[model samples]
Target: MATALATKPQVSAAEWEARQQLAACYRIFDMLGWSEMIYNHITVKVPDQEGAFLINPFGLHFSEINASNLVKIDIDGNTLDGSPHPVNRAGFVQHALFHRHLPDAHCIMHSHTTAGMAVSSVEGGLQPTNFYACNFAGQIAYHDFEGVTVRDEEGARLLANLGDKRVMLLRNHGILVMGQTLPEAFIKHWALQRACEIQVATASMGTPLLVPDAVVAVHQRDVHMAQVPGGPGSADFAAMVRLVDRIDTSWRE
Candidate 1:
């Protein structure tokens, strides 16, 4: 936490806004009990600045992340903001891979929550047994686990497995969700987590009821909930931001 804070005067309004949102996201995860000690990551592209992005410092816990302390780095993972914190090497292996190839993947988040990891390690990946899972139905992708994702070699396979889907369950590992914006990614993450949590809860209740593919299709195409003016999760993310702010305002630092 001794690292220098990127002050308002030091960065563009766009970049600073990105930093504050990313920091608030970290706090939101902490509030939702999504954080795992000091691990996992949530990153966002620097606004109007392609290739460069913001990430939490490697050593800080999610509760400790704040606007000024996030690290700025390129697609290759080299630190560009002169911050003293070291970017987690493993963070770049998969995150940077998507950032490089997926032009619209501006916000990427990865997590290792109990339900997420439990469903991932199960015989089959997420099933459409519940409402949230129905949202993804046949769209979730799976990647066979190859130990911790520290090698560059894993990026190519990850990219191939993900293709165009924004949500994936890393088999025997956890969840990864990408979005064109921070709120979009967060909403996807919320739905994925809920789907997995419900599936895990109902698995012991004998035969699990499944939503029909036809119904799932209808759910996916429902125009009533079309992208809000703020983006995919904009409205929900806004409410969440207000909640976290009520809990603690230090993330705005």
Candidate 2:
């Protein structure tokens, strides 16, 4: 558990709002059973702060995170605001690479969920066996894991592997999803995990899965075209926010 800070640094209204949304993301992760203890990370770029972002404090469980407790830091992992909690070194290195290199990747989420890790270790990454998997038919990337991501040089390899893709399966490590918004990122992560879960369950039956290439292509096109303002992803995310609000609104603090 992390010790709560006695005070929060003064920040801009936009920064504060981003903090609240990011904190809610943490709680949502906990509610969906996507958190791996205090490991992994979800980071959002501060609205107007160049190269600055917000991440969860190192020791807090996802459920225990709140707006004020999140640590604000630059791309280099230097603390921007005076917070007592230290940032996760590995998390910062991995996340900062994307944030610095990709402009559209405003929100990034990394997970170590059972299904996600299982699929990552498989021979072929993210097979298009179902609708969920098909959504990532040609939009996913893969990176081989080189143990814990502590070395700074690993960032370049990560970027190269993740070229022009929204999702990446870290072989033998985990999964990552990057998006223009927090809701989009969360929705993509949810879809990827579901795809992995379905793949594992079906593979255990030892029956040759039959999803036609044509069908997968059509599904991928449909998913991309349906990505509108009030579409499935955004709508479901809004509903989730309402559910999280009803359960415990402390993350807003």
Candidate 3:
């Protein structure tokens, strides 16, 4: 086990920065209650390193993730530099498919939140019943659940279902989203979580009202233009980063 590989001097500056940012993201997911123990994964591509990515140490809880402890690996899931911790190849089975095929998929996040899973199980996925739901409108994609995503062959099917959409609801599973950068991916998931939460909350309160298609069109346009306008350095992501910093800066190690 090479825990010494976690140090800044052990890797390039770009990789180190990516590690710290990704570790902070893990902490953010834990704080937001999106982590399903160590089940789902949030992976980021190593900057300037073709085909290289970073994923969490398989056995560690999201709350325990730190920059130094993350494992570096390739699209095939082989460790670039031996890690003290083993990497979960199951995560790579799905995530690698996107990072390899989509240029904009720099960071990919998957969450199994209770609300998300509930919404996924229904015939209709994420409805236009709330403001957050309206943001996605008719653009959310859906993929049929084929048990656990541990097979490499399933990667092609998942990508085919994803198409050009940024967000997808895996039927009977959860939510999956990818972005050109880490912050974009995070903000998108934030909206998805809220949409799912509201949908689940309304399910028990009688028939839910749906937004008109015309209004949803306008709403999507406005929300897109207003959200993360500053792109990668968006205040939406920066604000969350600040909060995590206050709660525990250990992820930055």
Question: Residue 230: error of model 2 in Å?
Answer: 3.3
lDDT of 2 by residue, 91-145 (tens): 9999998999899999999999999999999898888887788888888899998
Q: Give a tens-digit lDDT track for model 1, residues 153-250.
A: 88889999998888899999999999999998999999899988889889977889888888888888883376677668999899899999999898
* C-alpha RMSD values across all candidates: 1.8, 1.6, 2.0
CA lDDT, every model vs. true structure: 0.89, 0.88, 0.87
> What CA RMSD would candidate 3 show?
2.0
Candidate 1, pairs of clashing residues:
6-68
Residue-level lDDT of model 3, residues 19-54, one tens digit each, is 988998999999888888777899999997899999
Model 2 worst lDDT window (10 residues): 1-10
The collision pairs in model 2 are none
Q: Is 1 or 2 the stronger prediction by lDDT?
A: 1
Candidate 1 TM-score to native? 0.95
**True-structure lDDT of candidate 3:** 0.87
